[model samples]
Target: MRTLPPRIQNLTNKVSAVFVPLTVLLALSAFAWVLVIDNDLPAAIFRGLTVALIACPCALGLAAPLATWMTAHRLASRGIIIRSGDALENGGTVRHLYLDKTGTLTSGRFKIESVTTIDETLENPLALAAGLEQASTHPIGDAIRAAADEATTFDEIEPVPGLGVRGSLAGDTYALGRPDFPGQQPLPADTMTPNSRDKTHTIVLWRNEQPVALFGLVEEERPDTEAALNTLRRLGLNLHVLTGDASTQAAAFAQRYHLPVSTALMPDDKRQIIVDRRRETHKPIGFVGDGINDAPALSEADLGIAVHTGSDLAQASGDVILLTDGIAPLSDLFRAARETRRRIYTSLIWAFAYNAVGLTLACMGILSPAYAAIAMIGSSLIIIWNSTRGGSLWLRDEHQLTEEDPPTRSTNLTA
Candidate 1:
C-alpha cells in the first residue's frame, strides 16, 4: 500500500529535512574543531564523517509512516476502512461523539407494525407509500418497501435531507416523510398521538398536500448497542444523540442509553449544532451516522464515521467506514489509533536516542565511521520491528469471533 500520512507525519518530514542540513553543519564544526585541537587532518575528517553517518535521518523518516501503515493494515483486516491516516490520529483525539438515532444506535431493521389511511376511496395506500419511499435510503423507507408487494414508480423522485421524499404519480403530487414535511394540514388526532411506546417511529403520507395515511414502525436496539456505548463511555467520550425522532421517543432512548440528546432535528440543525459545539469547546468531535440526513453533520465533524449499510452520500462524506454490522468495532478503532501513536512515539524516541549517543561518541573519538554506519542501520531496524510487531495494534481472543468481541489476529506482516 502507498504511504498515507497524517499531519504529524508531515511534521516529521519537515523536522527530518531541517535535521539533515543541521547535522551536516555540526559535522563540519566537529571537523574544524578536531583539526585545530590535534593538528591531525585524517583524524578530523574521520570524526566528521562518523558524525554525519551516525546522524542519518532514515529512522526518523520511517517512524511515523511505518506505524500508520501497520495500523491501517490491521484496521482493514478487522473490517474498518479508514480513508487516510489522518482519521486514525483524529479518532484518538475525539472527546465527544454525536450519534444518529435510526440505523446507528438502533437496529435499522424496521418492522411495519400498522399502516392506516384516512382516504376511503384509495385502495392499498401502503403500496403507494412504499412506491414513494422505494427511492429513499432511510431505514423507515426500507421497511415500507420491504413490506409492500409492488411499488409504483414516480416521476422526478426527490428526497429532502431531513424531512421525507416527494414525487409525482399520475399527475398528482405525493410525499412520504415526517408529518410536517408535506403540508400544514393537521393529522388525525389518533395518528398524531405521542409515541409513548418504546421503539416506535411514525411516518406520514400526503397526496396533493393533504394527509392520507400514517405508518407506524417499530425498531429494536441492536444487540451490540449497549456494549458499544459502554465501551465508548469507558474511554472517556461524552456521548450525545442527534435525531429527527419525536421528542418523547428521543428522550426515552436517550435515558435508556444514559446519553444527552437533541430531538426533532433537521439535517441543517444537526450540522449547525456540531459547528457551534466546535467553537465552544475547541476539541475534536466525532459523528457516527448511517442515513441521508447524516451527510451534512458527517461532513462537518472532526471525524465522520459511517456504517457499511449507509447511503452512498453518507459513505462519501465519512472519513472512516465500518464494514461490519453493529458499532462494536468502534471502540477497537479508537484503541488502535492510540496504540499506533504510541508506537510512533517510541520509534522516534529510540531514533533520536541512537543519534544522540552516536554523535557524542563520534565527537569524543570513541566511535569509528564504520561503527557509526552500522549503528544507523541498526536504529532503523529497531524502529521497523517496534512499529510492525505481531502485525496488529491490539490482540483479541482466538476462541470467540462475534460482533461484540474485540479485534482478532490476522495475517502477519514482515518488518
Candidate 2:
C-alpha cells in the first residue's frame, strides 16, 4: 500500500479524513433530532449509533486492496508472479510494450541454419568454425560446434566476448565470429545472402586474415508468441522489438511479426530507447526480457517482466516474473490487471452510491435503524460479490498448452 502512487493514497486519505468528521456530525444531528422529537434518550442513542456504524467506509476501504488481492491470486495460479502491486496497477495503463529478442521473443537457442563457403576446395567450413568455437560457451559458438563433426579439434583457444573466438588449428590460426571482428574483411557484395524471411543471423569464419565462410544461424520463435502479440495488439498496445542484434536481423524479425523494431542496441542503448518512448508517448512502457544484458532496460521500463528461466540479475530486476516459458502469461497479466481495475472502479462506484442513498434516508428518518444496518451489510456484500465475479476471465483457451505442444528445452548446442 505504501508503494501505491502518492496521488491515489492522498486522495483516499483526504476522503477518509473528511468522511469521518462528516459521519460524526451526521450522527450528532440524528441524536439531537430524535431526542427533541421523540423525547426518548435510548431511541436517540440507538439511532446515533446506527448512523455512525452504517456510515463507516468499510466498502471504500476494501475497494482497491480486495480487488488487488484477488488479482494476485488469480495471476499466481497462471504462472505470473507479481513482485509489486503498484506495478500491477500501473500495468493496466501501459500503451507501449518493448520486448527483448533473445529468451523473450525467440527461444534463445541458436542452431546452424545453413553454411556457405567462399572456396569449394576448402574442407568443411563448419568443422573449422566448430574447432575454433569448441571452448566457447556462447549460443552461436555452441550452435556451430553442434553442427560440426565431433572429430573437429583445436589448440590454444582464445574467446572474445560479444565478438567471436580464435584458436590454432593444424598449426594455423582460425577465427569464428562477427564479420566486423578485428582485421576481418566483410563478405563480397556478390555473396549469396540467406533468406530474409527466415531472418537468419550470420557469423563469419576466418582462416588467418581471409574470410573463409559465413555460418547462418536461426533462433526459433516461441509458439505462443504470435497469439500473445495479437492479443496485446487487440488491447491497443503498441508493440516494438528492442534488441541488441544487428539491425537487419531485428528488422526482419519485426517485419515477420508486424512490429516496430529498434536494433543494434547496447544495454544503455535499450534503456535510452525506453526513456525516449516514455517521454514522447507519455504512457506506461512495459518491457519483457530475460538476460543479464537486459537488466538495465528492464529496470528502466515502467513495468518489467522477467521469465523464471532468465538470469538471476534479470529476475531480480523485473517487476513481474513468468514462472513458465512463452509470452502467454503476459496476456493473462494484462487482462487480470485490467479486470481488477474495472472491479475496483465498480466497487467504489457502488459503495459511493449506496452510501449516498442510505445516509440520506437515515437523515430523513425514513429508514429505521434496523433496516439501515441491513442495507449497509447488503451494500458491502454486493460489492464483495461484484468484485469476485469473473475473476478468471483472463485465462484464455489458447493459454492451455496441450501435451502435443513442443516443450521448451535448451538446444543441444554442442551436439
Candidate 3:
C-alpha cells in the first residue's frame, strides 16, 4: 500500500482554538455572577478583571463558512451547480482520482478514424455498409452515419441479429458485416487484435462475400486532458482511468502520456476497483465521469467529479462538478481549491499568530472585548480577501499540460 497526503487532517480543533478566551471569559462571567450575588468584594474584583475577555470576537467562526460559500459560488459561475460545499472542495484534498472513459474525458462522439480498404475508392463499399449500420443505435452506427453524412442509396435492407446486415446500395447487391454473417466474407489470417481494438474502435465492413474494409472509430481526446492531468501531477495527485471499455484502449490512452489505466470494467466493477484501492490506502479517492454508467463508481468514490455533460443523476451524486465540456476547466477547479487551501493555511497561520498576540495582551489585562472582536473581524476579513484569489493565470489556459514545455507543479521542475 502506498501512502500520499493531504490525508485526513482536520483543522476543526485548531480552528476552535479561538474559543479559548471566550470559554475562560464565560467561566469568569459565572464567577462574577456568584461574586455579585454573594456580596464578596475580593472575588468580585478578581472576576471583574477577566470579564473583559468575554468580548472575544467570534468573527473567526465565520471564516470557514464564508470561504466555503465564496468558493462554491465561483464554481456555480462556471455552471457546476454544487449540491454542497463539502463536495466541491474535497477534490482538492484527494490524493487519487479515477476518470470514466467515454463521454467523460472524451467528447463521447465516436467518429470514423480511417477506412482500411485494399480497394482504391470507398464509395460503393461504404454505401451498403452504412445501410445496415443505420438500424443500430450503438456508437459504431453513429460513427458510420457521421462519416457517410448524406444517406447512401439503399434498395433492400435486412439485419441478422448478432451478425451483420444485408443490403443493396448504389445499384449493386451487397452484404456488409462480419464474416460470421451469412454469405458475408472469408476470414483473413489475422483478425482484429486485442491491442488495436483498445486504442481504436473496430467495425468490420463486408461486401459481396469478401472483406472490403475495416472501419476504425476514434473518439477525440479533449484538448484539456494533458493540461488537467499535468495540474494533478503538479499537486502530486495520482490518476487512474476506470471504464467498461477494453484494457487495450485504456492502455493505449495511458501510453500516450505515461498514465495508468484499468479496462473491461462495468459500472459496479468500477466501484469494486475503487473499493479495492481503498483497502490498500487511506488516501482520499476522486472519481471523474460524464455518463449514467458512472453513477456507481461516482457514489463509491470519496470525491466524485461529474462533468457538465454527464448524466443528471451522476452529476447529482458526484462530489464535484466541472462545467467545461473538456478537462480544461478542472484545472481551474484545482487552482481554486489549492488557493482556498493556501488561504486557509494562511488564515490559520494568522489566526494562531493573532491569538498569540491577543493572549499576551489579554493576560496583561490590556486587551478588551472590543479589541478581541476587532482582531477576530480583521483576521476573517483577510481570509475572505485571499480565498477569492482562486486559480492562477496559468491554470485558466488549456495548454498548461500539453505545451512543448510541460508546466511545473512548482517553480522548480518541469512537468
Candidate 4:
C-alpha cells in the first residue's frame, strides 16, 4: 500500500487543498442566499453544512490505496508475491518478455543422454566426471554427481567460471566441463558430430590435458512451458528466449517453441540484451530467470519474475516471485494487474462523478446535511464493493486447467 505510486495521493491532496476553500466559499454563498430569501439563519446554516459534508473527498482519498490493497491480497492468495506494487501496476503493460531457458522454461534437472569416450582405456568416465564435480553447486554438476556413484571422491576440486570443474586425483588432473574448457584443447572432431542435433548440451571430460570423454546431457521443457507460452502469446506479448547455453542448444529449444532466441549470452550480455530490447521496442520488458547469472538481467528488466526454486540472488533481484514451481501463475498475474488497474480507474471516475452530483444537489438545497452524509457513505461503499468483485477467478481457472492437464517431463538432446 505504501509502495503504490503517489500520483493519485498527490493529485487528491492538491485538489483537496484547493477544494476546501472553494467548498467553503460555495457553502457561504448558499448560506447567505438562503438567509436573505428565507429569513431563516438555522436553515441557511443547515444548507451550508450539507454542501460541506457532500464534498468531503473521503471517497477520493480511499480510492487508489484501497484498490491496490485489494489487488495485492488477491495476488498473494494466488502464489505470486509482488515485491513492488509498481511492478504489478506495470505488468499488464509489458509487451516484451524475455525468458531464461534452463530453469525458467525447462526443468533444471539434466540427465545423461549419452557418453562417448575418446580414450578406450578411460574406464568409468561418468564416475570420473562425477568425482570432479561432486563439490560443485552448478545444476549441471549436480546432475553429473547425482547420476554417478555417490561414494566417488576427488581431491581439491576447483570450479572454473563459465567453463567447468577441475581437480587432481592420484597425481593426474581431471576436468569436467564444456568442450572448450582450459581454452587450449578442443573436443575431438569425432565427438562434435554427436552434438549436431543440438538438442542436448555436451559436457567434456579431460584427463591431464587430453580430451577423454564427451557426455551428452538432456534437459526437458517443463510440462507447463508450452501452455504458458501459448497463454502469453494470446495475451499479445512478444516472447523471446535469452540464455547462456550454446547457440545450437538455445536455438533448437526456441525453434521447438517457435520463439526467437538470443544464445550464448554472458551475464552482462543478458543485461545488455534487455537494455537493447527496451530501446528498440519502447515498451516494458518482463524477464523471467532463476540463476545467479540471471541476477543482472533480472534487475535490469522492467518487471523481473523469479521462480520459488531459483537461486537466492535471483529471487532477491526479482520484482515478483512465483511461489509455485511453474509459469502458469503468470497468466493470472497479468489478468489481476489489468483488472486491478481497471478497478482503480473505475473507482476514481465513480468517486469524482458522485461528488459532482452530490455537491450540485446540496448546493441547490435539495439535500439535507444528514442525507448528504448518507450519500457520501454510500459512494464509499460502492467503490469498496467494486474493488472486491473479482476474487481469484483467474487463479481458480488456472488450477482447474492444471488438474485437468498434469505436467509431464520430456527430454531433448542438445549439442
Candidate 5:
C-alpha cells in the first residue's frame, strides 16, 4: 500500500527539481567550453554526456525513500502498520509520551461491577444504558452492552468529547457518562462514591436531566503493560497520562504506573497539553490511545500510536497502528525507526559523496562517459542493497519471528 511521503523524500524531490535544470546547464556549458577549446565535436559531446550521467541524482532520490519503505515493510511483517513515512521518521525521536488510560494501558476488557438504578419508575436502566452505549466503542460501553439482555437502538446519538454519550430514546433525552458530565442534574444525593481506589470506575446514566442509574466497572492492566512501560523508561521517555476518568481513578492508574497525570481533561485539554509541551520542549511528542475521545490528541501529537483493537476513528487519526496484543512492540517500533533513520542518512551521505567525486572526475576528463554511466548505476545499486539489507536481517531465525506471524492482516480488528 502507498504510504505518506517522508520529509526526506520531499526534500529529495525539491533538490532534484532544482538540480535537474542546473545539471542540464552545466552539461551544455561543458560541451560548449570543450568544443571551443579543442574543436573536437565528438569528444566535447562525450564530455557533456559524462557530466549529465554522473549528475543523474538517481542515488540521491532513492536514498531516504528506499530506506524508509524497507523499514515500513519490515514493521508491517511484524504486525506493526506505519501509515506514513513521517511517522516512521519521527518515531525514533519521541522524547515524551502521553497515553490514554482505558483500553490503551489496560486490557480493555471491563468486568461489570454493578448497575444500580436510583429511579423506581425506570423499568430496566441497564438495558437503556446499553442501548445508548451500543454505538460507543469504549470498553465501558462494551461491558454494559454485553451484560444487558438486548441493546435497543437510539436516535441522534451524540458523543460529548471527553465526557459521555447522549441520545434520544422513546422521545426522551438520555445521557451516559461520568458523574460530573454536564446536563446530568439532580446529582445523586449520596455522593456517587468512587471505588477507583479498588480499581473500579463509576459512570452515571441520566434521563431528562435526572440521575437514573450508575454503572461500576473495573479494568485491569494488560499482561504486557509493565514490560512496555519499563522499556519506554529505559529509552528515557518522559511518560505521562491524560485521561477523562475521575481524579481518583486517574490518580490510581498514574500511581500504579508511576507516571504524572492530568485528570478529568477534555479532549481539547489533552491536545492543548501536547501542543504546549511541544512548544516548551521543542521535542517530538507521542500519544498512544484506543478510543474515540483520544482522536484529537492522537492527531495533534507528533507520533500517534493506536492499538489495533481501537475504534476506527482512533485508528484513522493515528500514524502507527499496533496489531500485536499489548504494547511490548512499542519498544521494537522505536528501535526500528532509529535504525531506519541511520540507514537513510548513511545512504544519503554515500549518494552525495559518490556524486561529488564522480562529477569531479568526469568533468576533469579523468573519467569517460561509459565509465561515468557505470559508476552512476553502481552508486544506485549500493543504495538499494543497503536499504534492503536491514530488512533482510529481520527474517533471520535468531530474530524469533516464525512463519505463523501473519503480515498480511494489517487491517484486522485484533491487537
Candidate 6:
C-alpha cells in the first residue's frame, strides 16, 4: 500500500471494480434459482439480472470519477488536471494548514529582500556581498547574486563546510553566512541586531577579519500571501508555517501571512510539529507543500494538500491535492469540498429514502424485481447528478502545473 501509485492502484481497487459486478452477477444467478425453487416465475430471473445489468451501481461507481473527471476537465480549462480525489476530500476539513516555506510559499529563490548593515557599511554591501556569494552554491548565495544590482569581482574563494563562503575582494577577506554563528560563537541580544526583520537571514558578512556588517537578508512573501492569510483567518484557520530556514525567516513569513511560526525545522522536525499539534488539539491539520522535502510533513498531516505544480513525491504523499497552484485557487477547493460533502450527504439521504420506499413496496409485494431494479438505478443516478455540482464550483488557477507531469490514471474515470 505504501509503494502503490497515487491514483487508483492495486489488487484491491482492481478486484473491487470487478468483484461488485461479478458478485451481482452471481447473486442474480442464485436469485434465479430461488425463484425457480419457489416456482414463482421465470420472468423474475430476467428482471433481477437485468436489474443487475442496468442498476449495478454504475452511477455510484461513476459518481466520484465523474466528479473527478469533470473537476479535472474544469480545472484543465484553467491549465490544471486533478489526478487525485481522495486528497482533495481530505484537505477540505483542514482546520490548520502547515506550509513548507521554501518551495511552498517562497519561490525557493533568494534575493536580497532588503539590506541593512550591522555596522556602517551599507553603501557597497550589494557589490561586496554578491562577490562573496558568487562562489557558493547555496540558495541564498544564488539569491544574493541575482539581487545584487552592482556587479562584483571575486579573488581567492574558499568554501567553509558549515559557516559560509570565504572570499577576497580588494585584498580583504570576507565570510558570508547566518548571523547566529554556526557553532563558533553566539551573538549577544543586542549585537547590532536587525529589528523589524522577521523570518529570514541574508548573508552575514565579516569584512577584513572583523564583523563589519551583517546582511539582513531574507525571502519575500508572495503578494498573494496577504490575501491568502486573510482568507484563512476569516475561515477561522490557524495557519502555521514550518521550515528548515532560519527562525527569523519563518517569523517574517508568519508576520506577513499572520501565520504562527515555527522555524529551524528539519523534515522530521516538521513531522514532529504536526504530530504534536495533532496530539494536543486533535484538530484536522492540512499541509501545503511543493517540494519533495515536504513529503514527510505532508504525509503527517490529516489533509495533505500538495499543489500539483510541485514535486511528484508531494503529490504521491498528500491526501488532498490542489491541481492549481495559486493560493487563490484554495478558495475554489474550499467551495468544492463543501459541495462534495453536501452531495455525499444528499446522496446518502436519497439512498436511504429510496431504499426505504423500495423495501416497503417489495414487502407489500408490489415491487417485483423490475421495480426494484428501476428504484436502484434511480437511487444512484440521483447521487451522481448531485455530485456534479462540484465541477461548477470555481475559483482561479495560478496555472502553475506546466513543469510537473500529472499523475496518470484512467482518463475515463471521473470525480
Worst 10 residues of 6 by lDDT: 406-415
Count of backbone collisions in candidate 4: 6
The C-alpha lDDT values of all candidates are 0.81, 0.75, 0.62, 0.79, 0.81, 0.59
**Tens digit of per-residue lDDT, candidate 1, span 71-133:** 878889989988866887888787778889888888788899887777877778888888888
lDDT winner, 4 or 5: 5
Q: lDDT by residue for model 4 over 111-221, one digit each (tens)?
A: 888888889998889888888877665678778877886535776788775577788888988888876675547876767888657778988888888898888888866
Structural similarity to truth (TM-score) of each candidate: 0.90, 0.75, 0.65, 0.81, 0.87, 0.65
| Model 2 clashing residue pairs (backbone) | none
Q: State in Å the error of residue 295, model 1.
A: 1.7
Please give the distance, in angstroms, between residue 278's alpha carbon in candidate 6 and its true position after superposition.
2.8
Model 5 TM-score, all chains together: 0.87
Q: What ordering of candidates by lDDT runs from best to worst?
A: 1, 5, 4, 2, 3, 6
State the local distance difference test value for candidate 1. 0.81
Which sections of candidate 4 miss by over 4 Å?
1-44, 119-128, 135-137, 150-176, 180-184, 206-212, 360-366, 392-415
TM value for model 2: 0.75
Question: How far off is residue 121 in model 3, in Å?
Answer: 26
**Model 2 lDDT at residue 86:** 70
Which of 1 and 2 is ahead in lDDT? 1
Better of 3 and 5 by TM-score: 5
Which candidate, 2 or 5, would have the higher lDDT against the true structure?
A: 5
Q: Once superposed on the true structure, which residue ranges of model 3 sit more than 4 Å away at CA?
A: 1-57, 79-81, 112-199, 203-216, 352-360, 368-373, 376-380, 386-415
- Tens-place lDDT digits, model 5, residues 1-415: 3356888889988988887898888889988989999999999999899999987587878888888877888888899899867987898787788888888888889978877778889888888888888777788888898899977678778987778899897789999998888857846556465444458888888898888778888886788787677766665566788888877887777667677878888888889999998988898889999888899999999899999898899999999999987887787787778678878889888987887787788778788888988888888899999888855433333234334322221111100
Ranking by TM-score: 1, 5, 4, 2, 6, 3
Worst 10-residue lDDT window, candidate 2: 406-415
